[model samples]
Target: MTSAPGTYDAAAEAIAARLASGGAAARIAAASSLFARGDAIPHERRAVMDLACAYLRLHPGRDADGEPAFDADDESVRREILHQIRERFLASSGDRWDHQQIPLTLARTYLPDVDLSKVHIRSDRFLSGAWVAGDVELSHATIECGDAEHLATLDDDRPHFQLTGEEGDLHFEAERAAGSVSLFDQLRCHSIDGVGVTVRGGRVRVSGHIGAVRLPVLTATQGVSISGLVGCSFVGLLGSDLKGEVSIDLEPALSAVDISWSAVHGDVSIFGMALDHGAARVAIHLERLTVKALHLGGARVSTCDLAELEADQVTVRECDIDELRLDGALVDGGTIEYSRIGRLSVDDATLGPSWVRDDPPARVDWLGDESRETVIGLNIVGSTTEVPPQGLIDNDCVGTMGDLLLDGFPVPLRRDSGTARSGAK
Candidate 1:
């Protein structure tokens, strides 16, 4: 039987009475009967709220006082009831549950493929250890902290989105299938954990300020793009295989960004990013990363560790970095034009024709511990200083003599025992 309009209270009272009169089996039967009749369920909003309240009432935790205690079998029955309500009553609804407080603590639950797009949840949503069958479309959805008044009293310069405690964050550690995960468009949340997730297909586009996102072991078949993040502390994508282009752009500042041991088939672009100087110093790690082309621009960081990087083309433009280590890198072509770096180390690297023209004279350390079998082609132009040649190996000038001028003097290209050796050219 369908409840009349504006009879949400009556429907909720009926559900409470029916569940109160039954044990585990009877309650499960009541849940099945209540959700089986689609017309008996109220609007999506009221139906979700009432059903969630009933579910919490049955499976009350330590905070829920004056509620009837249930055994393990009753707990299983409560999960079944929630599953029926989610799959049958709410999944088919096209309405967006906006500006509502979802009281269900959905941790460790098995969720079906559902569209929560544009849903504005005004509370914490915990989905840790949940397994999803298909795509998780969370584009334009927001999960706000329940304690807003306390957040407003904090300092503005500090990172307000860095939230702690279980009740103040959105825990989404669900494992999804080979469907696209869209987490962009002002999707504000305290933090997210996708470490246990593996996206077998579709692009994983993540934007907005989701504080301290940890997706270290995520394996996305398609590429991933993360941009427009503000006040983000950390972004961990270690040991991930993004089979397509990997693009990342962070605004203002961040603590650290690591993509070590990752492989990308397409070009990797990291621009418009600046590390926070107030926080501890952490390099933008690209160690052992294999990419098609690597581009770095408009970034101001303390250190950029590119040791053991395998890239076809490496380009650095308009950046202010303290140290740029290219040790053990296997790059085909590289250019450091129009940048200011404190120290540039290229020890034991097999790089093709590279041009180093940095402002304020960057220190170039291109000498390996021992002599190399083959000569390294390096073209250094502009006013770079402190180019010591005590431990120079087989190094030669890349371009013409005019293009290898350092301090307005042509660098001496000498030959020792039929092996070409040069200094700062």
Candidate 2:
């Protein structure tokens, strides 16, 4: 392609020819020269796409088994190439590449390792069914999807966008803005590390088989819904500040789930979760968590650490918990109905009646209520305070009570027997 001096067409031809014919070193030299000459040439999207395609064609990255090689050294070189292409060749004079609209769509395709770290994109990206060979480094990147109408036009029944890191994990640490990230049916990655990520006004939904997920120190203004995690070893959401609802639905055989030191403004629901029952006996950690309401259903965990929790209401229905700890918690009301709890501890906690008012009236499902709940060992010692009159009304303890320790009024021990006891220290 012949063009005038300092034209994008000329630069494109030069880069393409060098990548097609020259060796690796020669190709690098050519790309460097052209990329550094960004101030002289005009920035054209076609030229950028053509150069990227040429470089990808040069490194097809397939092994003898017809699979992506994903070699470490090759990935390093690819990262450098793409970085130079985006930063120098595609950027205009006196402008960083962060203010670029690079809309990309590669559905049902095969891609090698990708590194978009530190890049900012102001466009929609669709990678539905795209199989990535290696790691996807998105650390410090800003992804925005401005086309809400276009996103709404996508078919719901379409295949879930696949970001399978066959050889490596997905790195999302220190991300700036993840605008409207919707991973439709499921995501199949080896693992996801989203430490120190910030999602300003968008929601994050991922449902599928993931090896592990660590999203500690996250800040999300909107909600986060992650479900259908089958055989995932661990899920860590520690030290997060979520301003919306949080829902996590796990399988029965999960190892551990930790959401300590987090604050959620909306309801938090966890369903179908359990801990490892082997020799180690991993447990679920919810220490120092604050939420509006918490609901746990169909859970069979070894231990539930609900110490220092601040919530308006908490309900644990249809659960088979080995140990339920509520030490130093300030909860307005809670119910443990229709469950088999091994041990229930309420040391140094404040419990009250339900503040939620239903139109048709709510069902009475507290401890020792009409529900078919069975608590083996109950402990209410160490200066615990319950609301007057309505608190500890029906003492339906099927097992042993360590101490019927209360602050103010005398409480009954059983519904069948009229035994009013006062502070059995």
lDDT of 2 by residue, 1-425 (tens): 43442124544555545544435576566666555544344444424433443344333457899865655544544555666645732323356533333343322333454455445444332333334564344444444444455443432222211112333322211111223455322444555565565555456565555666777876767767878775567777899888889998866546688989999889888876333223233477899999999998767777888899999888886566778777788888766655566665666677665522122113324333523434422222223454332234334444222233334333434646443355444
- After the best TM-score superposition of candidate 2, give how far the Cα of residue 390 lies from its true spot, in angstroms: 8.9
Model 1: lDDT equals 0.51
Q: What is residue 22's positional error in candidate 1, in angstroms? A: 18
- Model 1 regions more than 4 Å off: 1-181, 273-282, 354-425
- Per-residue alpha-carbon lDDT of candidate 1 for residues 297-380, written as tens digits (9 for 90 to 100): 767767898988999888886565677877777887766644545556665566654444333222222212211211223343
- Backbone clashes for every candidate come to 0, 0
Q: What is each predicted model's overall lDDT from 0 to 1?
A: 0.51, 0.54
Q: What TM-score, to 2 decimals, does candidate 2 have?
A: 0.65
Quote the positional error of residue 65 for candidate 1 in Å. Answer: 28
lDDT of 2: 0.54
